[model samples]
Target: MFMFKNLKSDLPASIVVFFVALPLCLGIALASGAPLFSGLIAGIIGGIIVGGLSGSRVGVSGPAAGLAAIVLTAIGSLGGYENFLVAVVLGGIIQLVFGFLKAGIIGYYFPSSVIKGMLTGIGIIIILKQIPHFFGYDAEPEGADSFIEASGENTFSAIFNIFDNIAVGPTVVGLISLGILLLWSNVLVKKGKFFEVIQGPLVAVAVGIIFYVVTQTNDALAISPAHLVSVPVPDSFDSFLGQFSFPNFSAITNPAIWVTAFTIALVASLETLLCVEATDKLDPEKSVTPTNRELLAQGTGNIISGLIGGLPITQVIVRSSANIQSNAKTKMSAILHGFLLLISVILIPTLLNKIPLSVLAAILLIVGYKLAKPALFAKMYKLGWKQSIPFFVTVAGIVFTDLLVGIGLGLAVGIVVILLKSYQNSHFLHIEDNSNGKHKIKMSLAEEVTFFNKGAILKELDSLPRDTYLEFDVTKTRYLDYDIIEILEDFAFKAKERNIDIKLISKRGIVENPDSFIEFFKLRPKSKISLS
Candidate 1:
């Protein structure tokens, strides 16, 4: 079976992913204004149910950071947590419809640069957001709002608050776990197979739990359950199964539920597609996933998660990248991690409660660091202005704003830079030496040349020497911008008297522009080009 063969290769990764998921499950719950157990449920469902069905080998699904804002808002707007749960169920059904309709193709429409910006932006947000957690600030949960903390203050104020109310016990645990993680990661893994077999996160979590057990029994250094994860324990099998939440079929008539449902469906799908793309790149084998199949799997997963009273789920990049870094070679690693979540809640509820939140925070702090490493910035800088500008803009925007908005700003900047370069260069503008006693000057417009490049191109054409055998070649250009065509048409009048030959070619046909070129080459109202 796939599970048996990949067990060894995936064990270390599953442990690392487990540590990563544990905090996230808790943090997303706190942020969403939902019961903490709901997030854990979602994580279990994502891993066991969704992960098992995924077309992607390495992508790890769970309650997503991107959806926290929506979840928080929806719960308030719907007037109750239960109402929001209804929306979650509806959302999953909508996603299933979207998958069957082949809407997953929309993922391909997003530009690679924009997607890269999104990942880098999220990376910076993770690092900046985790700073308070690293310093032992537990008042505001990890993955709190970029604009405000639980105290309703901005990022800087939150940082100050963390420093002011630093918890010594949690801080100590954080530091110890961080130390073990760092040492195991940088030193131990490279030294021998034995150390590599047991990942740093596994070692860190094991140590944290052991520390908890020892200290709790001694009374002098006991950590309370509040500082650890507190999943409710079921007294019996029936009670345990009863813990699962079911969809309210009565909610079917509520228009508000449908609206919230569609929103979650759209956002969750986008995030999953993005995470899947990023995960594939992170994989050591560099395999590509079928986007449509991923959509279907994610949709099915969300339906199951919602039916079980869990939060909305998506393919999360942090966990997925952690999976890849852990050397996961098959989807079995992801599925097994899900099983671990399921089993842990049932069998090790007490032990889970002893592991400190600060320790998990320290683990995430490191995960955040790996994602937004200083070397990543340096490498982007070395790639020159073209790459560096977008990369840093993405980082800065994310640090200052939320994830989607930050990526949108970075994408806008990237598009402007691309247009500026295109305007400054010539696509078809060229000078040739004709041996037959004629100076052949050729000018070409780029495929899908827009008005952005019009001014520079027109200027270049106006400055061309007179009495030259000018050949206007639009053969290779598709969808010439009307402004450019108008300029060319104006040139044609004067060129006619000056003996310039204008030859226009397109998918439509070759034709000379008459009086005003705007009428001749204007874009059809419905005509569109694929920019992605």
Candidate 2:
């Protein structure tokens, strides 16, 4: 009786996400300095556990690109891989606490412009990071720490090194696999019914294995099994079961591990929160993900992943976007992808080894392009200066700094821009209230009205009609520049001269003689506070 009614609709999405996730999982592990198998384990847990419990319909979870830096640092700091595992387990506990405390609300504080900037910035990073891997560079880390480090010494330099001493076998296999993958996605799936039934990533992975096997027979192909995913195959069921590492409970008492735990929890939660927000925008159905529920799901997944020798996982936006673009219909597609991962590792271990890192790089490159295309820049620019300036600043900041820092920089700029715009338009100092017989004079402060607003204040006061009751409102103001506050205090003295009754209402309060807004807030010297 059980059946997937939307199987057809979900098929394409599953295939696309499957392809997108495969290399990301392996690359993240390689960058993290962990055994490649651990990445797959995280992928499985991310898809099955997190996917099942998520409020999101399309987002696919896995080890994140952003976490690669943290993972590398953590593995080194903890002294050993085993020690790092202990930190991960503890991290899960911290994430659970975050969910309980409703920390997901942190996503709301970010401005929309900043969020778009983050996406564009990350897209550029992905493309930059993958260039070396696509060119067959293996000596350096896949995701380097800084942009300058990428080449001449790191992954990019390693890519240059590969040109003269290119491993012919791996290079050939990688190129062939990449060709097949591209063809499958852009051609075969579109033209052939039989091929359409099969996922492009699954086929490409399959072809990669077959090529490896053919090359292995003659020893003519330079490619070796070591270059591929080196998943430890167990000879028996017990050995296979024994391969998973458990968390060291004794390490919980160590202060260093606890610190590591807290770091992981915070970073993972922030990434997950961002992913949830970004993914909702990509979903065609426009399903909004419940932030708190998503946190709980991510927390549970990380707890399990950490206990099982896996890297920390997050709801990744790229994978989620792939799922959306792929036409994923429900959560079932996500769960199926997890099962596919589980089966691939177990039954077809030999096949997975053939997947050339280059092929996966190509897939990610395409995804990166979609996220940070030139058209996106043009489109954002057309949205007006309010959107374009923030977006551009965010992109530039991220390129120069890191993700969070870049977003912060963009947000700061956006706030300042908004304040300036408001200030330029804040010439009005009063309005009329037809019903109250009281002249409701609404005064708006400039984006940054320091003592300079006193000139405007003097002008408005001089023009006040005789016997008028005035309501001086500054609620829409951003920064009540200190000068303006001083002017307000001075204006209190002239209200009687103007024959006007002045009522001040703002984020601060009615100032009889407000010295400084910041000083008022700090002093908490209450006068009269009213809200509309």
Candidate 3:
């Protein structure tokens, strides 16, 4: 119903999104070491089934590059792709349960710094991974996000290796495609609606296909099949149906299948939730997506995808952003894009296959640049070290390692920052010089004083001079940790030994010359004492 509401905007936006998602689906599948069709299947389902169910207007779902590493490893660990499909189905079920249980609240707890870091990190990874493809180096699989390649080369090494193995055909196509895309984005799109509707990536892809056709006779400019889009061609409708691989129902009982299922569910849900947050932020309309409903949609999509053969699905920021930039107005754009993938694969597989990977690489390069803009880094740095440290760490961790691991590392840093701030702001202390060689010290307990402030309080209490007047204020304190209470109780005795006068204050009444600080506090729970 929502899909048909904005046909004018959604139709053209869908075309742009289709161009962006086509290669990514195949690339993510290639990186995962699965049949290329699986990624397309996921894309189709994500666009149609999930898009139909999701409350999000612009969020796009597909086989994400973020899950490529997980899928690759899980496929091997589960003994085969068939068993992995069992896990995917089970994972979908688990996600459904999570949605029903209102587990989507977990997504809100991730710090903004870490989220921004993730975006920037993914952006950096995209740029790094696509560099080889841009140069016509096809050794590494497209959509591989890790720093180290499966071919035993690191990110920097892979970039350098591209220099030694450049193919003239792809190189020329990539450069031309990049130029056309840049020009289209900057100039042509601004001039008129016709140029805007044409979409740069679509033009780039069309040019790449034409370049491939023209270069067939010229060995010097001929692009290799390995460096071109490789969607499997089916001879008949029956053959196309055969491409879909069903899960091995027998594998459902296996513990390994369940474990893999849980892993997929957890990771896929997290990635989806994070993408939902990011997509909402990027939406010019600033429309809020219902997170629980999104989880339900993703769960249902994954279940159907696995049942009929497809990779795990998540809301993907790359595709969603492309949709937004293309001026997609509704979920119709996402649904249409999915249908386009399905129709194109069935009717025009040969045509689709002719597009060079280099052109797609150029398109991704622009996407990557947009995500990891230099301005973002400057902006984060200006937010100060508290925000910048976590942001930088997240980006570095994700770029140098895998997505989950990098996020974990960044979260660890973020938690530490939070703890340090909590410790610093837990309480307040003031010292003033009074007449007659005596100092007056006032300590105010925070609204909720915890054990973290114990050390600071103890240090201050220990540094007090003999014959000093100390005032401990807890009039506004609500919840005091037992450890802090004990510290104050112990300090009262020490103050007595130093010949300091004591003035105890509380909600009940002031207690001067209290026999025991512990008993005094126990008698009147909402109170503090001062020793002079």
| Model 1: residues with Cα > 4 Å off, grouped in runs | 144-148, 151-155, 216-224, 425-442, 447-456, 462-469, 474-487, 496-532
Q: By lDDT, rank the candidates, best first.
A: 3, 1, 2
lDDT string for model 2 (54-117, tens) is: 8888888988756777777877887777788888877888888888898889987777777888
Residue-level lDDT tens digits of model 3 in 1-532: 6557778788888887887799888878888888989999999999999999999989999998777778899899888888888888889999999999999888887888998898889888888888988888877765534553555676778788987899899999999999998999899988997886678888888899999999999999999898988888998989999989989988777898888889899999998998888788778998889999999999999999999889999998888987887788999899999999999999999998898988988988888888899999999999999999999999999888878788888889999998888778776888877846677777777777777777777887788889887677767777776777788778777788997665666575777656686675663554543322
The digit string of per-residue lDDT tens for model 1 on 53-133 reads 888989999998778888888888887777788888778888888888988787765555556666666666666566666
Give the lowest summed-lDDT range of ten residues in model 2. 523-532
Model 2's TM-score against the true structure:
0.78
The prediction achieving the highest TM-score against the true structure is: 3
lDDT (Cα atoms) of all candidates against the true structure: 0.75, 0.71, 0.85
Error of 1 at 13 (Å): 1.4
Report the Cα lDDT for candidate 1.
0.75
TM-scores, one per candidate: 0.86, 0.78, 0.93
Alpha carbon lDDT at 364, candidate 3: 83
Best by lDDT: 3
